[model samples]
Target: MEEKEPAPGGLALIEALVNTLDVESGTDALDTEENRTRFGLTPADTPGARELREALRATLLAHAGHHPATGPRPPELGRLLTAAPLTITIAPDGGATLAPSPTAPGAPALTARVAAAITEALLAGVWHRLKCCEAETCHWAYYDRSPASRGRWCSMSVCGARAKMRTYRARTRPA
Candidate 1:
């Protein structure tokens, strides 16, 4: 029997990390002793680092976010696996970008491993190696830094052939 393609669970974890906690956006202003009482984020309340870690636990478990066009892209992989994979986009000009998996609403409809994986990927983006898919119409992107430029389609038969088939038909079609 043929194996089926895996879900985008990792991607969902990524979106959840960025969107649920607003980790990227609110990094600079999150915690402090003063707000500890109000926000309840302090070493005392968060004793032994367990509470601290747990406090951020909710923020860490998000498995979905938002997409402009589609509204939300489910991180099917994150849902399936322990840690959802995160795909980073590095521009030619040396800019780093993160694309979150689409989310439906409130929070993760699945697991926590997805969020951890996304956080890991975003942190790694600082170095490089990840990238978005080149196809314009298809928003689904991937990470690639192969030496021989062996990277092409997001998979093999999907985006790659879509282009080739379109071009071939256009070339052979009647005027």
Candidate 2:
């Protein structure tokens, strides 16, 4: 059989960024160390993850400053699997419109807010798993906790099966 596609770590970077701002899960989970790692976070408190999180916070704050609270922020903008291509515009009348997103001039505008939005969409868990493996050495990571919550491993052939085999051997071995 063909090998399964590897989880996109690059994309994971974006998703994790967004998940960090998840009004419900991300915010609540970040308050603790274990939850942070469980969410595949890279310790924003130190250098890696914390830095990104802070950067996102700054972007959101900047945007909020410009746009007064028409209504409360939608608890982290729900979830997005991809950087929506729609051009989100707010008319002076307070109405919003979704047209095609503008292309960045030259290479592209590296706006902080847009960057944050992209990252968040990646972790929105819209297209990927928010949780990761308990085992080391395996990058098999991506769990979709659907209604069944049947997801048990990043990849059964890699992480899940290995875990199962290890457990079986341990139980079968002479005590």
Candidate 3:
């Protein structure tokens, strides 16, 4: 797999959250205190964060024309995003942006942040460029920077190569 640049703006946050879990290794960064703090999550917030992560992963997978293969289906991302407590704030330059409500704590606050990021990405016309790798074992989130915006795997050197090798072996082996 090739090294990918981070997604721009708030989308980076969404990307980071979605990547917290290494699906193949079953290691979840959210299980660590430092990572939990990065997302404003507490020990009690881990379950909710995991739910949100999976939901985001599903959405990113859809962006790449793929479906999640395991785990109970998460709540619809739209429903979860709509429930976020976000308010619009207008700057002196007449630019308005979404901000999480002050009273939202922990997971809710993180949700609000994600909602705001999605909103920004949509307006920037780059939401669809953020996608999960098509490799089921490594559904890692990545920003699709290809000129055609159809990047399939997170890295051509890794997942892409593995998939090609598999197809080659299948073609050459005895029936």
TM-score of each: 0.29, 0.36, 0.94
Cα lDDT listed for each candidate: 0.37, 0.42, 0.91
TM-score of 1: 0.29
Model 2 TM-score is: 0.36
For each candidate in turn, give its C-alpha RMSD to the true structure in angstroms.
Answer: 17.0, 14.1, 1.5
Candidate 2 lDDT over 48-133, as tens digits, reads 34444444433333322322234534323322213334466789999764443466321112222334445544555443343333
Q: Itemize residue pairs with steric clashes in candidate 2.
A: 14-119, 15-122, 15-123, 18-120, 44-49, 44-50
Q: Top model by lDDT, which number?
A: 3
The backbone clash count of each candidate, in order, is: 19, 6, 4
**Model 1, CA-based lDDT:** 0.37
lDDT (Cα, tens digit) per residue for candidate 3, span 1-175: 3557899999999999999989889899999999999999999989988888888999999999998896678768888887799999999999998989999999999999999999999999999999999999899999999999999999988999999999999999997
Candidate scoring better on lDDT of 2 and 3:
3
> By how many angstroms RMSD does model 3 differ from the true structure?
1.5
